[model samples]
Target chain A: MGRHEFLESVAVADCAVEIEGDDLDDLFATAARALAEVMVDPATVPATVERSLELTAPSLDLLLYDWLSELIYVKDSEQLVFPVVEVHVTGGSPCRLTARLAGGPIDRTTTALRADAKAVTFHQFVLEPRERGWRARVVIDI
Target chain B: MKTLPVGDCVWEIPPGEKPGMRVPARIYASEALLARMDEGVFDQVTNVACLPGIVRAALCMPDGHWGYGFPIGGVAAFRADTGVISPGGIGFDINCGMRVLRTSLTEAEVRPKLAQLVDALFAAVPSGVGSKGFVRLSGDEFDEVMREGARWCVRRGYGWPEDLDATEGGGCLPGADPDQVSQRAVTRGRDQLGTLGSGNHYLEVQVVPPGGIHDPRVAKVFGIEQPGQILVMLHCGSRGFGHQIGTDYLRRFDQVMRGYGIVVRDRELACAPFGSPEGRAYFGAMLAAANSAFANRQLITHRVREVMGRVFGRDPRDLGLGVIYDVCHNTAKLERHTVDGEPLELVVHRKGATRSFGPGAPDVPAAYREVGQPVIIGGSMETGSALLVGTAHAMTETFGSTAHGAGRSMSRTQAKRRVWGEALIKQLGERGIVVRAASKSGVAEEAGFAYKDLGEVVDVVDRLDISRRVVSLVPIGNIKG
Candidate 1:
């Protein structure tokens, strides 16, 4: 199944995405994929290198913001795009995120960067339980 | 949602209009422009009015639009002793601003070679997403740039020392602590000193069309001697460095706001009191990022001169290329202002507004103090831009602030759906404007129609006596990222 889908949000001047999964861990993984898709064409980037990161925030919503923001920071600073993602969330008063990102250095010859996703905004950001599973929504500042 | 007419081209949202609003919110816009403004702008402005220690009313310029927290083109001042500082107020692109340089050559002299000149510029100036810059600074050198700004560029032989005199705050804001900036931000900015990033950033070659000078006296003071004279306008900012700083601080403030007993309506408006340790640290880091921006623009200016020199077969100085002025649109500066019939020191936050000090103001450069500071308004590539001067009226009403640009009326996605990049390129070509862009999608996103009419926006400010138009420049060529 597809990890995530794009959503229309006029409230933000930039793009938004909705990720669906069976649990919190799945939701984080899907959210990471959605973030990567916003920056570059997913099919073009090969999962040649793997990197792992851990982040902690006070709540699930903030954990999502931190996770996505870290991706942007990695892309801009290291010029790499992640196509494969694995996320695990440990639920507590202080939420912690462990993510494994797999991608390669941006080769301008083949990889076409669609948008420069500057940061992950907190505007209307949400991660919650749904009737069927877990759902997350994030608006990116492009 | 109710608005009361205050004065010519002005409307006010009374303090009571919104719960928690401590002061009134005023907007400068004509009837037509007001109607087109997004309803969210009112909410954002009112929300800003509720911030702790905000002085006067939260003011939105004619170009105001709904942004993340504060509306773009929003200006507000707060008492330094009690106010809170929010990175959102200054925006992610710290010191994102405009700079204009005039050349002795005229439109007629350069029209034939416009394509070649644009190509040269496009190559000389690195642009677009993931683009690296020409200057690769060592860690120590990068720290110096954070502390010194344009002055560092001048010392490195990238710009003339005199250029600093023509810049806002002399191109460097004091209290920049390089140690406050994170290592990640430093790494991101190390190779991006002279780069132009994507999304609404561009370097345009423009001309002052015949009879475009609005005020002869002001134009003379601005070094604009004749109509049809060529000028270069570059719009960019602190790049990755500023974005990282803003991102880092927003998260930090969001966590600490609870500790300070501060509650903001929006998380994006997260802040800490000015006297708090977190607030001082963010301010210091923000200044460092702002300095990096000044140095970035200065380096680009140097590159522009180098390219022009090569293309025209003359020395850059021989071509009479000199900076008119460089001003920031997004910043928070510690300034003194008169409020409630008393002089007070405050921190003025201009999100998407420019500082427009009036004639005889101490901040205005000595050469142009009699006329006033130049307020650069960059419009779309297809339309044109305007040069305006600050007025005394602005100082009293708006903390000496003015609109930055023709605010976006359509989202980037909507704009792309409405216009085809190839077709727009052809249309601009027919209008005698040459454009070189790295991405076709970016070109489509920045279609001229996406923004409100600059003429109407500028007119509102002019009628309100916030700023007076000096000259209008029509674009002949542009290089977009």
Candidate 2:
């Protein structure tokens, strides 16, 4: 576990975020939490349902993009919000990821929907190893 | 970073200014507007000039601003046989556009009941984050919507057949193959057909003020004969469906780019050759999403008409609720344009820009052929909007394209920090503009100061003769997602 914070980008109309962790797996998990926080208050989402996803992408940056995009798609199409997200990454080159997202159905009374992130844009998108941890910058198209 | 003055309100970066740029990059802006623009716009437009098969130049409109790859208000044309198609060039919101409907009622007649009408409209149309629409489609029917676009809605009684005539491309782009659309995209689109998704999308009730009409003859042709005439303008597009398509294609194109031996300065500009298998597939899928957007707007129009009828106590027809025009700001259309005095088929990509075909163009509807295509430019709620008609100069200089809106001058975060949503709402209310939105923070994010002035942007295009102003619209009420 590490830290994730929202950043600012003059190039886009929506939110930009920076996530860091001890390794690739940790960074992915923290990034998911950051995305969840963007949509609603994580404290309000009840972790009553669980969804598991296996995704693959050509590169690490794209893997993060696909992960976030899948979460957004699930949030919109299934009407579910995830409060807890776990990611496990293995192998190399074309990386593989297995993620488990736990949350409940969205209810206006409990969930204060903040923003609907349409997709993760590749504009200035980066995922790289930094001193002490792995750091990534992603701009979410809202 | 260097540019030379090419014409009044125009600046150009020569082809050799960048190492791989095949054509010049042009920006249409007054000196004041250009001074306010972010430097990223220059980088993005110049990068676009380097794309494969880009013809003549990569052009930015007066309202241009930095975007992902192509600047917002960016326009370019590529040779049909040699050029490539990129999702970034068309944008995530496929056919994200503006539709304006005129009514016989005047502002004076609706002023007292403005709030009530706004409430009715807000209730009728599903809006805000993750909101679903009243129309739920089965998987099979959803496929039909992807194929037939607004025509599907007309067949289902959502809109009248004549409404399509006022829409660009007749409210549907041909060559849409439903099978090319992914199941995930379809699933996301199924319940969101008539929804106005969040972030700058809105439905507004506007009035033509006494001084708003710029040209009396053109205004009359556009159905704006008298001051205080009420009109409804809606800005929206394909919801989750287009987002999914854009996401899916960007990733696929990035992976395939290496095989095509194509390299781009930005990964977001990923593309495939127009004749390539990947390019054709994405084009088909993009058209499906474009059609989905047309149907979404048509259904929303139907909802607006219903609300108006209820509020006015008259049939929508009797109320004179007829569509003046619907034009998409984000799209890539294959059309014939003359390059170097030779007629050639080209794929024109307009991201955050509008098509402004001049009078007598075959694509213009017969009713408007003598006046040219009506271009709808939606400004922020506080500043109001404008209607302009294309000129022959637009076709010759910009491939029949023009500015889409008063582009953003500040980031959302900056806007939110500078303006309190509640206070801004109060200010607008004091000015006789009723504003309703899902979130106050969202309202603040789109504060009037966050965007460039519409008047200046319109003035530049008008002075340049790219698009001539017809009328201006002052907002009376608006609903934002």
Which number leads on lDDT? 2
Identify the leading candidate in terms of TM-score: 2
Per-residue lDDT of candidate 2, residues B307-376 (tens digit): 9999999999998999999999989999899999999899999999999999998679888899899999
Report RMSD (Å) for each prediction in the order shown.
1.7, 1.4
lDDT measured at residue B451 in model 1 versus the true structure, 0 to 100: 87
Q: Flag regions of model 1 displaced more than 4 Å.
A: A1-12, A18-22
lDDT of 2 at B444: 85
Which stretches of candidate 2 lie above 4 Å from their native place?
none
TM-score of chain B of each: 0.99, 0.99
* Local error of candidate 1 at residue A85 (angstroms): 2.0
**Which candidate leads in DockQ?**
2
- lDDT of every predicted structure (CA atoms): 0.87, 0.89
Docking class of 1: medium
